[model samples]
Target: MKDLIFDNFQNAVDESLLRHKSILDIITKLQESEGRINRAVAKSVTNCGCIRVDAKKQELPKEDDDIEQLSNALKTHIEGKLCDSCREVIEHEIGNNLFYLTSLCNALDLNLYDIFIKEYDKINTLGRYTLR
Candidate 1:
């Protein structure tokens, strides 16, 4: 099976949706994702056996720290299937993620699609990770 270049492809979803909408369309995708995520979450939890574990005691990072402990911790929990599948909620999260990626690209004067393509191509050619 072919590996997906964008493991979380939803981050770019909003860019496609906004192709025909005005600037205000940015908020549209965000709101849409929020709704979808909510629904998915609700469905997943309806009858699933899930566990919620609090992070072990640890000191908070200092202001100048570059770490994102919370995000990393949440991702670990999610991947561990601490909860069941929530399709509706996942959809919105995917869309909103794409929207943010697109926004970041625009801010940096870069093209997300092109960047992704180029990165993939480089990865394929090198057969391993290497700085571009």
Candidate 2:
């Protein structure tokens, strides 16, 4: 019975990992497309009565290192047991990030609302409870 329970637990973990991997793949594609879309919008906006505003892009110390660093930081925070203040900060930051993403999608002519609804539907179909 112990072995059976362990196998079931392992299977659940594997399934969750696969789902995460699939989501990552989708996000990667979206990120790649964002660059192209941004360039195209930059070109087209000049004649479309839209103001072309250029903001200075911030450069990181190490390019493409943010994800790993963030993952490590989050792991450390979780392992160390996050304080209420830290949790609040994290939650706020997540909201900020989501807002930024939605703004970017709008600027890029992407239907963020539709995309969000589709993803939400997928999650809803997975037998998870969501606040209405």
Best by lDDT: 1
Model 2, stretches more than 4 Å misplaced? 1-81, 125-132
Summarize candidate 1's per-residue lDDT along 1-132 as a digit string, tens digits.
Answer: 122444334344434454634445555655666676665654554555353334455555566754455333333233225332444447657766566556545545566657877978888987523522
The TM-score measured for candidate 1 stands at: 0.37
What local lDDT does model 2 show for residue 35?
60
Q: Candidates' lDDT values, in order?
A: 0.53, 0.47
Off by over 4 Å in 1: 1-47, 50-85, 128-132
Candidate 2 structure quality by residue, lDDT tens digits, 43-94: 3334332334444543334555655454343321112233454445446555
- Per-residue error for 87 in candidate 2, Å, reads 1.5
